[model samples]
Target: MSNSVKTINPATGKVIREFETISDQQLQDKIEKTHEAFLDWKQRSFDERGALIRKVGDLLVENQDRLSKLITEEMGKPINQAPGELQLCQGICHYSADNAASFLADEERDLPGGRALVSHQPIGVIFGIQPWNFPFYQVIRYTIANLMAGNTVLLKHAPNVWGCAEALEDIFREAGMPENVFNVLYIQEDQASQVTEHKRVRGVTFTGSAATGRKIAAAAGEHLKKTVLELGSNDAFLVLEDADIDKAVDACVTGRINNNGQTCVAAKRFVVVDAVYEQFRDAYLAKMKQVEFGDPSDENTQLGPIAREDLRDNLHAQVKESIEKGATCLTGGEVPDREGYFYPVTVLENVTPGMPAYDGELFGPVASLIRAKDEADAIRIANDSVYGLGGGIFSEDEKRAERLARDHFDTGMVSINGYYIAQPNLPFGGVKDSGYGREHGGFGMREFVNSKSLMIAQ
Candidate 1:
């Protein structure tokens, strides 16, 4: 395997920088150092760990602009969205710093003879395998929670965003954190299994494709180590017959085009009731076409290039195959003649279950519109996917919408009359093939730690 780390700018398809990859011995040393740090770090009081995490939050805020720019240049995210992602990173850090002590506090119970207590303890060194999309936010989501719980981190970032990975290490150092408390491994893909299987790495946290997540989970299981997998999603946007057509159309446009429609939780499937299907489709198509696509650095540009060229090609192929297989393209279907990896914001109508785009997650600026006969049909279509990550219900009647959200949508999270977005205070994860384990809120902090139940002899 090659030991070279090349940074390519996806926006322009140019080489930004190339660095020497870390050797096997260097990776082994990193594991050793992280283990050593965990020994002493876990003994520290919760307040101490919280203080360190708070410092991390402060550092993120101080260097948001620089970090955001690096992210934009590395992966072609919208410039405006880059700062927002940085703010999200800061918010997660602050959330963990402020609440981890309380979240992880020992719970004392009354026993027949004596008192029993349940404690949340750190699971030693945590291995984080983060993806390129939302690079900083994804890493911080796992790191802050685990570090606040008194565990050190070993981060194996996506190959495309190596600069951002290095910058993160610098931020931790600037915050006065111990050197070994957080380490970044510059290993090639071939070495991922070896690094994840290290004995000291007690738990694994991964956010990526289902295929890769399964492989990682299997490796972690082989070593008897716990793992948390946050895989892909084909989230649905359901519009009821009694819904406000304008509001539903607006939400669908934003949900499908945001982040160039590369988000795991982006609304890939749109299930709309027949009563309002025609109006909603027309409005949604117009809005999607009006979105300006250009350089992400331009403030007026609503959509930016896809993260990578391969992703753009894959999305284009899916769109072509869907159209060839009988799905009608309502808005876009071709690549734009632009400098970057740009593809037109696509909208497909009459999408059936067997179509290529309908069967798989459309990880681009393409929206699949599937008409439903009624509430039951809408629910049936929404729940027909292998992914059960997130979904949104649009309806005029709040009570009815809440009922559908509770009973019909087969997802981990549901939004009534709103677009799907995760907050730090709420639990986020999925069921079925979307992967297991939760992130954010109290559940996120506990995912990287061990819950020890104590019993007393009567």
Candidate 2:
């Protein structure tokens, strides 16, 4: 229970900066101010809101270099990939600003005796608890949509990315957003719990682990408040009997190691049919072994250190436990003898249900390879996990792959013949243990809004 938030550079394992947490009284004042701002904000026209939101996107473009560097320094995302995260954030803001009006406009419907109108209206202040994995994108994912929906926002970002949070607040300010329309909370866990209960806070949105998402859902449920949770995933990538082995290997390698494999939707499991298992495994392992790990800022570094020492330790522990439980390590399971919190790109074979590598998220540069009897078994293995966030299918038969992805993937989203990340126009989120609700597309703009029905008789 420290009184201040300290950020560390995972590349050097050194403290970057420290900022003091706000007092309880300050927290209360900020909440009140945000709610007050929401009252006026919700009354403004969508065009007005959209104009301001578009400015936020413009600011992101203007400051991409500085902000991307900040992201790499704070969270250990490779410098090359950090800009891509901001690029996604920029798209989110622009998309929300452009489409939210049409998405939230009133709709005319036929009623028993007359016409009915359904209008989506903003509630009030929405509180978001986001992770550090994609600092800018995570915040923008929720914030822009809520703002476009006319609700003021309060963010309790991960402590390790407090600097990113503050930078966002500053960006909103510079974009001429009214005071207190978007606020960042520098508070402890206990304080966050209290904020969730505040009467002014109408809804909650969280992105993190399933265990923590449950706690958030429970806390919000006690008050009968609305919530949207986007939790973790051990996503699977399938290789069918007629799949393109080289194509699958290239995509799978990038899918697992991108962001140094810290992505929640990153492909963790490779389920290959017996026909292609050996080929896929051999090529996948060879490429994974060649991933260059170094300082995040280095242009040639393909893999950077984990976000923190403890996360690296936890990832290594999972690898060890999986090895002890009968999984075979093919490459890069050892922590490197380096200065930073570096773990090499690892590949594990023969992963089964009882092992951590099979059942849980590694959250680092580790890949799990599972052999399947055939395409049916591969599909079964992919759906076997409690998480259903996102998964992939690789096959030469596009029609068959599409059929499986559309009908049997059992996840919020699926990729056909390759891998993909979050898209501003597509829905994101998961089911079962991966948490509930959807973001991006038009769904996020309506997640926290009220749809009121009006009956009219002529």
lDDT of 1: 0.87
With candidate 1 superimposed using the best TM-score fit, by how many Å does residue 12's alpha carbon deviate from the native? 1.0
For residues 269-334, write the lDDT of model 2, one tens digit per residue: 999999989988988988888897898988678999999899999999999999999999998899
TM-score of each: 0.97, 0.99
Model 2 TM-score, 2 decimals: 0.99
The ten-residue window of minimal lDDT in model 1 covers: 292-301
Residue 308 CA displacement from its true place in model 1, Å? 1.1
Q: What C-alpha root-mean-square deviation, in Å, does candidate 1 show against the real structure?
A: 1.3
lDDT of each: 0.87, 0.93
Alpha-carbon runs more than 4 Å astray in model 2: none
Candidate that scores best on TM-score: 2
